[model samples]
Structures are given as C-alpha cells and as structure tokens.
Target chain A: MKAEAFLQCSQCKKILFSVEFEQLLRVCPHCGHHHRLLAKQRITATFDPESFEELDKEISSLDPLEFPDYEEKLEAAQAKNGATDSVISGWAKLDGMKVSAAVADFSFMGGSMGSVAGEKITRTLERAADAHCPAIIFCASGGARMQEGLLSLMQMAKTTAAVQRCRENGVPYISVFTDPTMAGVLASYASIADIILAEPGALIGFAGARVSKQAGVSKAPSDFQTAEWVLQNGMIDKIVHRREMRTTLTNLVKMLSWRLVKHG
Target chain B: MAKTWKEWERPLIEVEENIEKLKQKAKASPEAEREDLLKRVAEFERRRDNYIEVMYSRLGPWEKVLVARADQRPYTLDYINSIFTNFTELEGDRRFGADHAIIGGPAYLDGEPVMVIGHQKGRNITERQYRNFAMAKPEGYRKAIRLMEMADRFGLPLISFVDTPAADPSVESESRGISEAIAASMLKMFELEVPSVSIVIGEGGSGGAIGIACASSVLMLEHAIYSVIPPEGCAAILWRMPDKGAQAATALKLTAAWAKEFGLIDEIVAEPKGGAHRDAIEAAGLAKEAIVRHLKLLKKKSGSKLKQERYEKFRKMGRFLSENPVDALAKTR
Candidate 1:
C-alpha cells in the first residue's frame, strides 16, 4: 500500500490528509477548533495577495543586559522563524482595506515582547496614527520578555502611549487575541481597542491560570480563560471563526472606512 | 520589635543585637563596668555602621529583592501618613466593587493640592488580607482610573507610588477585565494634562506596576527593584527551576541603578544603608523631596506640554532602535 501523509487534529484528534488540513487553514472541520497559525500563515490569511510590504525588516534585538543564552536563543529563533523578533508588522491591505497590521508569533520565545518587538508594535501604531489608517493587531504573547527585564516591562507603557496617540488621531484600533495572551501584553495594548476579537478557544487573560490558582485568587471552572469566558466577562466584542475571519474583517472595513475607502 | 534578617545580613544583625544588649547593661551597671560597657557599645555601634556601609553597598541582586519585599518595609499608608497632610482616601470603582489593593484620592503634598495613588501593602495580617497583599484587581485599577480623571479635571499634580508583585491573577480578576482596566489606567496616565511623577518605593513587578507608573518623571528608591516578572517567576520560566531565583535576579538587572542607567527611570532616590524599611520616616522624607523636586520642575510646563513629554518619556525607553526615529517610522518597501 502507498504511504499517505495524514495529520491528527490537535483538539478533536480526527485524522485527515495533511494537505487538505493546510488548505482548510489548519482548522478542524469537525469541531471548528482553530489551530495556532505562524506569522507567515497569519499574514497570508489576513492580508491581500502580494499586499504585505514589510517594515523594520533590518531591526533586531541587541541583548542589552547581555543575558545568558539569550543571544543564542535569539539567533536560533531568527534562523527558524526567518524573522528578527517575535512580532512582524507593516503597512498592508487587510481585506481590501488599507491598514497597519502587527502580528505576534508564538513560535519565537513564546512571542514575548522584548525591546525590538515592542519597537515594532510601537511603530505600527505610530504609523497608523500618523496616516490616519486603522490599526489591526493580532496579539499572542507570554507577556514581557524576562531576558530584557525592566526594558521589556517599559514596553507596556510605551505601547499604551502609542495607543493613546492612535486614538487621538481619530482612527479605529482593532485587536485580535490569539492563543495564550496573558500578563504584560494583556494588561496593556491588547485589551484596549475599538473592536476586540478572538479566535475560538484562545486562552486570554491578565494572569496565568496556574499562577492565579496558586495565588488562591481564582476558583474558576474549566472554561475560565477561554474566549467564551472572555466574551462573558465583557472584554471582547466578537469571536470569529478562522474561515470567516476574512469575511468578518471585510464587513468591518467596509463599514468603518465607508467615508475614506475609495469605491470603484 | 522582632525583626527578620536575610542570611547575608546575619553578621550585621548580630553586631546590632549586641549594641542593643550592651546599651541595656550600660544603663544600670556600676560606674566602672558601666563605663566599659558604654565603650564597648560605642565600638559596636561604629562596627555596625561600618558593616552597614560595606554589606549594603555590596548587596547581591537576590538580597535587594528580599529587601524590596521586606516585612517591615514602609507601605503606601505609611508614606501617605508621613508625607502628606489632611489626606482623604477615595475608594471603590463604583462600577463594580472596591479593592483595597490600590488607594488614592486628593491629598495635601507639602500643603499643595495633589492627587496621590499607591499600592498599599498591609502592615499586619488583617491589613494584608484587606489589601490583597497589594496585588490589584481590575476594580483597583478602575478606581485609579476614576481618581486620575478627577486629578486632570481638578488640575492636581498626580503622584503615584508603585509597590506590587503584579496585578491580581485570578478568575474573578480576569472575569472583570483586569487587563483592560490596567491598560486603561496606563492610557489614562498618558492622556493626563497635569504634571505627574511615579516613585517605585518597592517591588514594581510586571505590567501591574507600569499601569500607573507612567509619568513625566519615574523615580525609584535605591534598593527597590522593578522587572517584567518577579525573580522567582523568571527563574521558573527561564531556568526551568524555581530555586534559581538568585541567578535570575542577577540576570534580570532589576535594580534601581539598572533602571536609571537604562534611562527607563528618571532618577534613583537614595535609600538608607539598611533600605527604606529600616527608617520609613527618612524614606518618606526622601520620597517627598524627590516628588516636590520633580513636580516643581514639571509644573513649569504647560498641561499639553506635560502630556506630550510624558508620552515621549515612555516612547523613548528601551534599547532597541532598529533605525533612527524618523527612518523607523518611514515608508515601508
């Protein structure tokens, strides 16, 4: 018998052809659980074809404190992810709408916000604010990078300040929370937005489940930090499925940019 | 009063204890022995000072963390009682419930009207429970937001004291949108037109600290430590072992000196040799001096200018500049 490449869904454990699963955007057809996407895959999913023009491609971290094994890890992540940092952002056309989009990749150091990643996120907001374009961000992070210490912590303030400027410029800011958005990033820019959306089953909260459990603050049920729980908590506006994400965003862009979006 | 001492501070504590013991004996002994006891007491005092100077100057990163979280450390209420007058605390988020983890309201700082906010670590068990060990929930931050808005409306200079392990990490906190509350608090600080200063009196842990610590001038006391995560948390994540907290503390560079050198903080207010916990009166005085100085300097600027400067202050923080300011935001290819 000929060998066939197959994959098991992470959530549903259903076997399927690998190529078909990739074509379906890695979402399980049976259960509709959206798997985590890489930055490249996310860009392809969100932006128009050939519309992604990279920004700050040359910017990378300097290992400021000379933290042990950090430089090596950065190098390894760079080599594997083909990016300088955890976040990849730029001016792009999202569902035919002009926008500045920044996406965090959990593959790189758990998508932690170090100085470089922060600078990229800041520039994304700054650019959006200055251009009066909508800022759309896909946030996936383990909060601030411990390797960068206080510098990483300061990014929360920096990004929040950027968000302030973006809001003052009178443009909408949209945030999409992905899997495991917790701690510093959650406590800052990820939570404040014009419209907040999340993928199905994403673990989104300010503090970690284990940490909260250990701290004796949360005697939560099994579905505590899930997107449904976040929705129930009134933190997010909507939960969009993977296949319908582009359509939902298109409708939003059409409504928001009705005045500015040049009609053909 | 009973005191807790770290392992590294054993020798200094021993000498100090001896000074206390001999001083007791010197007060009641016969003339001859009293004189000798007095001389020995003086010698011990001198040695104690010497030990303090040397040991404190050479405090390891872990020791600083320990000191920053010392049981006797001056809590927010202590500083408020010592530094401000006619203080009236405004509590409750109004939207939900009250959180004693954070407390603030309009107060008289040096006889001038100013809004003061701080993380209140409890002095006793009851207070600690009341304060949630200074770990703020969403409502705590929301309360801060309300007070800050009032400060802007009333044209009061805002002063915030940062002292927290982190924001409360719990089911209830998350359910109430703790993340959004904190982010809103930070954004509110940036939006404030009034001159402001934030002083890190102790542990400025993670985003919880920065939620209110964004100001025109961010100051930290000499021994206070601020970081993205607590040392123990960092050790567990980075080294895969919680016992490697000492090593993680060293690597994190969370000291006030590091913050100053990195330009993340404006100044490092000097603490006494034994840290601010030893003499909270002096600590509050030093904090008052720094606050008055920064507020005076900031008050000269127009409200709009203060807001702009505050935005730039945080915007300019960090070691990463992939390109120059203009080029980084320049056109992307």
Candidate 2:
C-alpha cells in the first residue's frame, strides 16, 4: 500500500481505513493511541464551529543561515501542509467562550519552531492579552528548526517572553502537549503555562528519546518521558484524553477568565 | 589531553613536542654552550606563546567550541568562590529530591547580597557523574525556580552562570519533567521583581543554557559558545554526519561575536590573553565587574518596568522579511 492509502497504528500495528481514522480524530480505536495531527485538524477539534479567526498568516521564516536546500525543503513542507509554517494561530471560541489559540502541526516539518513559527505564537498570546482572555496553545513539535540555526533557538526566549507578557497582563495561558513535544518548545513555552495539559502517551521532554539515550551514560526506564510518567511526576496539571480535551480546555478557560475579571 | 583536544589539537601538539625535544637536547650539551642553549630555550618559549596566540586568534568556530568545552575551564562553582563571599547554598526543589547538577543560594557579591544560581560541572570522573557534567535534571530547574521565587520575595538581585553542554537529556530527566521545570523557571524569572544577570561562562548549549538565562542582561565570555544545539549534535542531525561538526559550527553562528552582533546577547566579557582556563581568578574578576555593572543599572528601574523591558528585549529579536512575498501574502489570505 502507498504511505497515505491506509492507516496503521505505529504502536499497535493495526491497519484501519483512512475515513475511520479521521472520524476517530486520528486516535487508534484498537490501542487508543493518539496519532499526531495537523494544525488545521487540531483547530477543528478544539474550537467552536465557524469561530476561528486566523492571524499573523503573512509571516514566514527567512533562511538566515542559508542552510543547504532549506528553501526547497520549506517550499515542499508548505505545499504539503497548505500553510506558511508549522504553527496555525488565531482567535477562536472554546465552548462559545472567546479565546486565542495556536496549534503546531507535526506534519509540517515535524512541527519545528523557526522565526515565523515563534512570531506567530508570540503574536497570538499578545492578541489574547489584548482581548483580556485566556490563551491555549496545542504543542506537537520536534523542537526548534535546525535549518534556522540560532534563529530557531532564539524562539525559546522569544516565545517564553511572550507568555510572560500575556500572564503579566492578567491573561491566563494554557499549554496542551500532544504526541512528541520535545526540545526548545517544551523547555520554553509548552511547559510554562499557568495550566499544562497533555494527551495520553504523548512523548514530552527536552531531548528526543533516542538522542538522549545516545548522549547519556545510563539507560532510561521503559515509561520515561511519556505523558503518564510526567503526570505521575507532578509536572503537568492533568492528562486529558482526545475526547475530553475540548471540554477540559473550555472549563479551564472559563474558570481562569472568570478569576482574571474578578481579581483585576 | 581530553578526548576532544586529542582529536582536534594533534597537529599543534606535535609541533610543541618537537620544540620540547630540541630544548632538552640543548640542555644536555657541553657546559660551553649551556648559556647559549638556555637563551635559545627562552626564545623558543616566547615563540611558542606567540604561536599559541596566533592559533587562538585564527581558531575556527569548531575550535572555539572545543575551547569552551575544555576540561580545564573553570565551572560555575569556581567563579562563585572567587567572585562572591559568604555563600550559603540551599538545596532541593521541595517537590522531588535535590539535583546536584545545579547549585544556588544566597551570597555576597562585593559585599552586596545577591542570589547566585548556576550549572555545576565536576573536574573528575566520579564528580562528573555526580554532577551529570553540569547538565541539570528536572529537580535542578525546579530548585532554580524556588530560589528565584525567594530572590523575588527578599528583593535580592539574581545572577546565573551558564556552562553546560546541554540540559540533562537522559530519560530520567525527561520522565521527571525537565521540560516543565525549565519553562517554569523561565516564567518565574520574568515574574521576579529583582535585578538579574546571566553569563555564559563556557558552553551555553540550548534549552539547558536558556533555562536559567532569562535575565535582564545576558553576557557571554569571548571564548564561550551559545547555540540552540551543540555543534556536534547539530551536524549529526542536519548533515547526518557527526564529523562535519566544524562546518555546522560555522553555520550555527554560536560564537559570542555573532550573538552580540545579532543582539542575542547584551554584552561580551573579554577573557584573559589565553582563555578563562588560563586564569580563572582573573576571569571571575571580569565577570564580577560585568554583573555588578548590569545589576546597578537595573536596580534603579521599578520591577514592572524591568519585567516589561526584558519581555520587549526578547520579543524584538530575529525579525526578517519573507523572500517569497507572493506566497507569504497568499498565506495571509
């Protein structure tokens, strides 16, 4: 079969129809594995009908390093993902409550954050603060884009600074970690929210598992870096299933926004 | 020689060894030529110094990376001992156990009370294992969060020294929420109502470096290298060839000069003639002056203003116009 013809669970190795997988929100029905999603898919799953307003769409990354074939790779990724970059962001309504959100699409260059990706995220939070509402970001990244070089690395500081500004303005920020959140994104914006939530079995950490294993002197435990492990270790606020993610976000936004208004 | 040095400095080392052999032969010659031979030996020493100086000046980006990671380079603790007084180290994140990879507590810098936090590396094998070679785990970052919170509460200035290759990337560190801990520390640092300065003393590698590096002013030593990923790692990932690390370093723009020119760092602290490893005490003295200067400037501003300025400082970096204007405009549609 062609790579995109039918879906097979990477974890369970169970083959399924493409339509069924889409209907299931890309979660495997057999093993309940949450597969990575595109930015548009995540937006569709999280926001109210016809309420998402995209922002900062004109911004795109520049090859400051002039990395070999970076332009070709970026163009191909854009064509495939139907977006300028890895992240899609805008103001949206969660359960009819207005909020701003940004979602990283793993399909787009492994959801790496380059200069444009970081700018979009920062602007989203700034807009959320301006609107005096809570902000939520769905993260599914392989960390900072290597092609952008130091420019990619600076995003960690840039995005985290934006999160700080949003919070300082009394706007609540929530981070949602999906499958395979790692590196600069995780260490900066994705992990620093007032409330952090994650999908079940998501791989979340600073370094990728294989890379870390090779760099480290000791072997890691079987469950290390998994969402369940992080939850048990008391880092994140909660672990929400794919079905419950929207509701959990809705309730959190409502409560936090209400607190902001009352306190301010 | 360290493994990295043997690999990179072999050719220079061979020249030095040959010079040493000539000097020994001269010393063993008859008494008549002893004085002349001694003079030649002295001349050789001067020439060697000049040669090293030239080599240092012409060092490629990868060579700079090696210098930054040199084992003889002084770690954070050495700086603290030389620059600060009356240090009282506090431990534990209070959520999990304490992490040895990071050290922080109240200290007196030039008789002024300040909170010092830094990544701690060891000089020996056992110590390196204990300190995880200065790579902090989750608990280490959490403890940093706690100390920063305390600094805010007491109105103490914060100073952090960065010298890790990267954050501890082991599975245990990830499982225990190293990412969250780092993020939390950054957020808390921004929220803190205290003057803060961070210096890259050596290898300021990636998220591990930035975790404690969110300060009002970020300074890097002349020889230090800061990047999103280490050059070797970046080469491995980008080219799928680890041996292309030197090329990757050139591409990464990780040197202090590049970082300063790009406005990524506020200032560059110049090292002694050789490097920090050549004279750590002098390096500490220079670091002290830089930190004190920034802290004094920052102390006059109100906490809110400092926070706002810091936020804006990072927000203003890495701006560029897209080359594909039509594509960019269409995406905006």
Q: What level of docking quality does candidate 2 show?
A: medium
For residues A189-225, write the lDDT of model 2, one tens digit per residue. Answer: 8887899999999988778778779866678778878
CAPRI-style quality class for the chain A–B interface of candidate 1: medium
TM-score, prediction 2:
0.90
lDDT of 2: 0.85
CA error at residue B12 for candidate 2, angstroms = 5.4
lDDT of 2 by residue, B94-164 (tens): 98788998999999988889999999989999999899889898899989999999999999999999989
Candidate 1 lDDT over B185-255, as tens digits, reads: 99999999999999999899887898889989999999999988888888898768888888888999999
TM-score of chain A of each: 0.94, 0.93
Q: Candidates' DockQ values? A: 0.75, 0.57
Model 1 TM-score is 0.95
